[model samples]
Target: MPTITTADGTEIYYQDHGQGRPVVLSHGWPLCSDAWEHELKVLADHGYRAIAHDRRGHGRSTRTSAGHDMDTYAADLATLVEALDLTDLAVVGHSTGGGEVVRYAARHGAGRVTKVVTAGAVPPVMLQSPANPEGTPIEAFDGIRAGVLADRSQFYQDLAVPFFGANREGSTVSQGQRDDFWRQGMLAGLQAAYDCVKVFSETDFTEDLKALDVPILIAHGDDDQIVPIAAAAYRAIDLVRLGTLRVYPGAPHGIVGAYQEAFLADVLEFLAD
Candidate 1:
């Protein structure tokens, strides 16, 4: 369980394995480094240095009461990469983790990073405004916050339903997958989890997308119920200077876990390019 102390003194837990080029992974909201277990093994086995870290208040990382915003999330990731002296890094982020990588590239530039992959991620923006009318309503995000405050445990359990597409008519995910999602969500700090709802839904990454220099692959599920394709990856692809959009037909927000083989193969192919 290797950990790095951020400038703010938060103990960020990370996993570094294998050798060769580094493939850094950032997990989704309320999830941790463990969320990338499938991707990690594949990357490591394929001769890539796989690295995944628990965001500030998730997983085995220290549960701080503050800095649960995108700026801090990106900074923490930057600190980890810098500390490890990793070069030509291929940053892959899922859901909220996508926002983290986009912000990192925008804020820090792509001197060390070579490419990026955002899978089932939130970027550009998720919330509706006068400018971006296609965004999800603020009330929808408010409902998420209300759900978290009401019962953190049950809220996470309920979220796992659609998260893994279990609510669909012909879901490919198993009960164990939903249970695993619940376990990871419950492990996150209550405050950080609640705060992240705002971070993921409200934070704008439009400028970040515009600032991207390195090649970026925007991956999303066409059937994703959590982050709609039309509002997320579709719009994100148009913003990046060097971007490619790949849709996983009939996949869910948790596609990385549900469609592990395809997801890994798609990413490996993108990294090879």
Candidate 2:
């Protein structure tokens, strides 16, 4: 397994495959690069290099007790990109990883990044501070933190319904899909998952979005139950000058997988432009 050592000496594991224009994927919270397995095959078949990393404390990466915040997460990705010496790379981030991509692009500039796509990303801020009156309440995140700390296995199992919009009246959720999600969530370290609640829910990406000049594609499910589309997706689209928002009607937060064909098609078209 290929790995890169962060400046702090943390060994982060990653997967680099295919040979063409590089397309890096950053996964959502409580999940790892395995979340991109479906998308990776699509990208590879279309003649693009597909790479994904198990975020620190998730999947096969080190289960560190500290540095679980967004800053460190962004830095870890930057280190991977530098180690690979990649350019003209298209970064696709989902949920918490979406926050990492925006922050990394802003912090490092557009010289190395060709384009970016954020799906169900929590950004422009998620916590409802005085400055961000429309953000989600801290109590909501607190609930998540407490759940993970108490009984992570059950917590993750319960999370699947809402995360995938299975609770909705017309929603269809297979037992296999739910099982896969639970398996991935359980694979991650409990400490990292707990700490990351703050990283994804509290970090402010306002400055990052304001500074981004590269072409960006913002896709979100209008009916997302995990991270409300109105607060996260809509706000992000408004912040970026060159950002294009593609709303998937009645789709859940896991729209990339739930609506794989359409989502992949849009991404391929966007990359072609």
Candidate 3:
């Protein structure tokens, strides 16, 4: 497996495929680059170079007990991009990855970034505070942390039902799909997964979102149960200067896979414009 050494000396695994305009994908929390496998293949076939990396404690990357916060996450990505010497890149991030991309563009500067997209991203802050009354309560996140620590396997299994919107009355969820999600969740280290909860839930990206100068596309599902669109996706759209918002009605948080064709079309259109 190909890997890049971060500033903190952590070896992160990644996949680089195809050839054309470069697009780097970042996956959400508790999942690996495999989450973007479908998008990568589609983008690569459509004349784009696709690259994705497993975060420090997820997938095939080193399972460290520390450095699972947003700052470290963005830094690791910056290191990877610099190592590849990529320019005019379009960075697409989903869920937690969405927050990472926003922070990366703001912190590292957008000299090499051409465009950015955040799908079902948790940004502009997610945790509720006195100032941000609409954000998710910290208690909710505490429950998530406790659940994962108590019974990781069972908690992950239960998470799939809502994460993919399989709990919806007319939705269809396959055993294989659920198993694949579970398998990926189980592959990650416990400490990393636990710590990441705080990172994605509490890290404030308000300034980061406000600072991005490149074109940004915020695509989120209206029916997202994981990270509500109002507190996250919509908030990001309002903050970014050149951000465009697209809300998928009745779509779940996993809109990337659920509405693959439409999502790809929109992304291509944005990237083309």
Greater TM-score among 2 and 3 belongs to 3
lDDT of 2 by residue, 1-273 (tens): 889999888889888878899999999989988889988888999999999999999999888887998888988999999999889999999999899999988897468998999998998788887777878898999999999999999998899888888888877777678777899999899989998998999888988998998999998888888888878988888889899999888889885445666788899999999
**lDDT at position 99, candidate 2:** 93
lDDT of each: 0.89, 0.88, 0.88
Best by lDDT: 1
Better of 1 and 3 by lDDT: 1
Summarize candidate 1's per-residue lDDT along 151-221 as a digit string, tens digits: 97888889988888888888878778788888998889989988999999999999899988899999998
Deviation in Å, model 3, residue 159 alpha carbon:
0.3
Error of 3 at 35 (Å): 0.6
Ten-residue region with minimum lDDT total, candidate 1: 255-264
Please identify which of the two predictions, 1 or 2, would achieve the higher lDDT against the true structure: 1
lDDT of 3 by residue, 97-209 (tens): 99998899888846899899988899988899998888899999999999889999999999988988898887866767777788889878999999999999999999898
